[model samples]
Structures are given as C-alpha cells and as structure tokens.
Target: MGTLKNQVQLIGHVGQEPQVTVLENGKKVAKISLATNENYRDSKGEKQTNTDWHQLVAWGKIASLIEEYVFTGKEIAVQGKLTSRSYEDKEGVKRYVTEVIVSEILFLGGNGK
Candidate 1:
C-alpha cells in the first residue's frame, strides 16, 4: 500500500516528438505529450469522444529510452508518479504545471524506431 502512493499509470498515444535536453551536469531529460481518449455516450445518447493531454517527464536512463524510441503517434505504457511545480513565466506571471515523472515504459503495437 505504501508503494501505491502518488503512483500513476497511463497507456496512450504520443502527441509529439520528445523534447530532449542535456544539462551542464551531463544528465539527460526528456519531455513528451501524451493523449488519452475516452469514448462514451452523451445525455442525448450521441456518441462522443473526449481527449485529454498529459505532460510527461523522464530523466537519466528513462529519458534516453524515450529519446531513442518514443515518437509522435507511438503507443506506449508508462508508470510513474505525479509532481507539480510552479515558476515565473517571461511575463512575470506565476505558472503552475503538473507532470508525470516516468519510471518505466513499455512500447505497444508499433515498430519502434
């Protein structure tokens, strides 16, 4: 039960190419956008599809794996934890963001590059 704290698992399509960056300390970090879709019927019984976008971040070995194989439209499964942070934007306004810090990944149904 303790290990379940803050855990998150998602299986979805990658929305864009991973943005990879290397810090001066030589650590690699990658960021990606994932889209999860749900289909349901509306109150009127009309079919509807809803899509939600998520922000994902990976570090070190996980980041390297993402850089090598994850790409736009790729389907993948990821397990991680949720984290949130705030920063001041260029406009000097406070910005808050939530992201999943990926710990594990599994490629699904695609010939990975």
Candidate 2:
C-alpha cells in the first residue's frame, strides 16, 4: 500500500464569527469560516489577491476556545484532517460539504483585528 495521509495545516484569518451549537447530548460543536489568500502580480503586472474560504469544525474543548477567542478577522493556525460528507437538506435535496475537522489550533499574529 502507498504511504498516504489525510492531514491538513493552514494559517488564515477567521472569515466570520463562529457558530457554536450544543447537541442534545450536551456536546459542543463550533463551525467557523476561515479565509486564506495570496497576493501576487499577474502577467500584466497588476497586483491582485486571491482568497479561498475554508470550513472548519471544532469540538468539545476546542469548540469552547473558538466560542471565546475566535472572531472575525482573527488569525490562527490549525492542524486537522479533511472530511467530506453528504446529507439531505430540508427540501430533500442532497447536499455535500467539505470541512477540516480541527484537532489542534494556535493563535497567529492577529488574534483579532
């Protein structure tokens, strides 16, 4: 078998305020949007920035940390595994989502700005 992994690491600014929810089992889950981007000059020498948004999910203690510390424009580094799943929406339409299931997080230069 080939040596393979499903890990991901990223450093970016929080795209929005995390939405924290509590399950019936009293477990906490937080969903956060992260913005990662790069700036470069195009072929015409025009400076431009391209940003990609990522979906991040944190659980338990990490979820609490996100609720208390993470905010829009906050910068943070995260290590996690990429996950994808599908579910049916209220309209009975299937929806697919990709997300980083965050395991560890570190505050970057801008905790919040």
Candidate 3:
C-alpha cells in the first residue's frame, strides 16, 4: 500500500490572541493557540471534561488574514497538516514542538461584533 498521509481538521475556540511576527526578509508569520474540549462521564459516573491545546501557524497572505480576523475566544475551523521541528533554545538545550500549518480557516457564526 502507498504511504499514508497526515492531515488535521479542527473546530475550536481560540485560546489566546493571534500574534504576528515579521521577519527581516519581509515574511509575515502568525501564531495562535486553539483549545478543544471534550465532555464525558467517567467510569465512576462523574462528569469530566478535558481540554487540549494546539498551536497553529499561518504564513504570507494567510498570516495577514489571521491577524485581521482572528481574536481570543473566537470560534474557527482550521484544516491543515502537521509539522514538527526541533531547535536549540537560548539555554543550548534541544526543544521540540509540533504545530498545525493552517492551509485554510473559516470563521463560524457571525463576524466579531
């Protein structure tokens, strides 16, 4: 069989405000965090809730749109692929992170009033 692919689709609330960073080369990058939640009952018959956080990044024109339309607590649907990278921190320790590089995003409900 052919190799499988990696894909991600999520509809969640923005955890925090979107942050835009401009590189010296004039490239724009937008970073945002999203929160997804699940509600269920545990084996003990008690209510439980779990929340997961995801980091999202957009580039170029998408970055601009994200900066303009995205806000903390906004509901959005994002479709993208996963990307993971490792880098050295200022302390010279290796750190790893995974982010969803958003290829498309949609605003749900009405526009921010």
Candidate 4:
C-alpha cells in the first residue's frame, strides 16, 4: 500500500529533445514534455482524439539517460511521483508548477530515435 502512494505511470511521445542542465554541484537534471493521446468516439459516433502534455523531470543517472537517448517523438514509459513547487519569477509573481519526477524509464516502440 505504501508503494502505491503518489505513484504515476505514463507512456507517451517525447515532445522535444530533453533539456539537461548541470547544477553547480555537477549533478545533472533533465526536463522534457511528453504528449499522450486518447482516442474515443463522440456522441455523433465520430472519432475524436485528445492529446495532453505533461512535464517530466529526471535526476542523476536517469537524467543522464535522457540526455543521451530521449529525443523528439521518441516513445517511452515513465514511472514516478507527482510533485508541485512554487517559486517567484523575475517579475516577483509567485508561480506554481506541477511535474512528474521520473524514477524509472522504459524505451518503447523499438529503435527510439
């Protein structure tokens, strides 16, 4: 039960090349957008597709893997937990952001290029 707490799993296409940054301590972090699509039939029997974008973040070795292999349109699966943080922007306005902190990643669809 404890393991299931705050767990999130998503499989999607990478929206763009991962942005990897090295911290002042030489630790690496990576960020990317993933797009997931859902297809369904409308009331009129017409097919419709909805796409949702999610922000994903990775640290350490996971970030390194993303820096090397993850790219635009590549399909992958990630398991992580949702995290929210607030920060003040340059304009002095408080901003809140929600992101999935990736712990596990699986390359899918073969030859993830």
Model 4 lDDT per residue over 29-110, tens place: 9999999999999999999999999999999999999999889999999999999999999999999999999999999987
lDDT of 3 by residue, 45-101 (tens): 999999999999999999999899989999999999999999999999999999999
Model 2, residue 56: C-alpha shift (Å): 0.4
Q: What is the lDDT of residue 41 in candidate 4?
A: 100
**Candidate 1 residue runs with Cα over 4 Å from true position:** none
When superposed on Cα atoms, how far off is each prediction in RMSD?
A: 1.2, 1.9, 1.7, 1.1
Model 4 — which ten-residue stretch has the worst lDDT?
104-113
TM-score (C-alpha, index-matched) for candidate 4 = 0.94
lDDT of each: 0.95, 0.93, 0.93, 0.96
Off by over 4 Å in 4: none
Global local distance difference test of model 3:
0.93
* Candidate 2 C-alpha lDDT tens digits along 7-91: 8999999998999999999999999999999999999999999999999999999999999988988999999999999999999
Error of 3 at 75 (Å): 0.6
Provide the TM-score for each candidate, comma-separated. Answer: 0.95, 0.90, 0.90, 0.94
